[model samples]
Structure formats: C-alpha cells, structure tokens
Target: MPDAYFLPDYRTIRYCLMKHILHGFTLIEMAVVLVILAFLLGSLLMPMSEQMKQQKIRNTQQRLAELKETLIGFAIDKGRLPCPASTTNGLETAGCGDNTEGYFPWRTLSLNIRQDAWGHPF
Candidate 1:
C-alpha cells in the first residue's frame, strides 16, 4: 500500500452501517409481525365481550332495583300493589301470589323493561 492512512470517516462508517440496518422487512418478518399483532389484539379483545355481558347483567339488576323501588312507591301511594301485567300484551291480567311476589308489571309500572339482558323476558 502507498504511504497513507486509510481510516474510514465518520459519515462513511455511518452510511455503511445504515446500509445494512435500513433494509425493508422480509416476507417472513412481516408475517411474523402480523401474527404477533393479531395475537395481541385477540388477547386484548377476547375478554371484552365477556365484560360486556357482565355489564348487561349489572344493568339488568339495576333496572330490577329501580322497578322494586317504583313498586314500593306505588304501594305506598295506593293501598294495594298493582297486579302483574301480561308479558305479551302488557295488560294487567296476572294476579300476585299470596304474599304479593310476582313478575314485574312493566305496563302498569310504565317502565321499559320488556326484555332483560341476553334477550330474555323480564
């Protein structure tokens, strides 16, 4: 070699390093990333639907509590409790049990609880 120092400059070294590091992702790498994202997202969202169902159950219980309060208020206002309304037509046709335990009368109460969570009738 000629009498000369051959040290690489900082910019040359950086460019060479970046040439190796800044390449596009390979097909396998892309697929792996997609799979990892899907797994993470699925893991996050899997319990969300179950949580939503639990929220619905909580809401139904709240509605039931409100209905109870309304019924008690009505009983307090009137001398006797109102009869249970028909599930189909909402007409006051069903009588309460001997102790006044029965289905909630939606129509008589003028409440909007035709169906509970999971599409079941109240």
Candidate 2:
C-alpha cells in the first residue's frame, strides 16, 4: 500500500517541495547579488578613475605648453637657445658652455617626443 512504482506520493512530495522552493537564487541570494554588483562596479569606477587622472594632468599641461612654444620657436630661429640633449644621442650639445643641465633637445628641436606624460624624460 505504498508503491506508486516505488513511492513518491503526497502529490509527488508536494510537487518536489514546490519545485525546490521556486527554483532560484539562495546562496544568500547569490551572495547578495554579488555584493550589489561589487558595490555598483566600485561606484562606477571611482569617477572614471578621477577622470583618467584629470586627463593625465591635462595631457601633461599641454605637453608643457608645446614644449614652451617649441623652445620659443627654437630661440627665434636659432639665434641661440639650442644645446641641451646628449644623454648619449638625443643630439644637441655642441656646447651648453659649463654644461647647463641637459636632455630635451628632441633631436635639436626637429621634435619627435623624447618622453613625458608619465614615461619621464623631456
């Protein structure tokens, strides 16, 4: 008197316990919806990472004001101001007199990026 093929009656154990309690989330509600979607994707990526670090510090202050107006238009077309580079081949340096610092000749101002905006140099 208890063998409906094997024995699962009472309306199939109350419809398999109401289809496993409505069949859904419950590992603490999917870990509280994955911790509220990782706290809403970390508050929307923290102001887009501080607006990409203030657009890389305003693109390194507009590339140091276009390299100080290309070194004042190469000292008004080469009347003076060149020499600086030569940390072993960035050019320039025929004579910065008593070595007035160095680096930034950008190949004697023909320009082509020596580095900046985080890479350093320049």
Candidate achieving the largest TM-score: 1
Model 2 over residues 49-74: C-alpha lDDT tens digits?
99988997888888888889998988
CA shift of 62, model 1, Å: 1.8
As a TM-score, model 2 comes out at 0.43
- Candidate 1 regions off by >4 Å? 1-25, 94-103
User: What would the per-residue lDDT of candidate 1 be over residues 8-97, giving only the tens digit for each residue?
Assistant: 578988988777765644655888899999999999898998899899989889878887888888889986778865454454555566
Candidate 1 clashes between residue pairs 3 or more apart in a chain or in different chains: none
TM-score of each: 0.60, 0.43
Candidate 2 local distance difference test against the native: 0.80
Which pairs of residues have clashing backbones in candidate 2? none
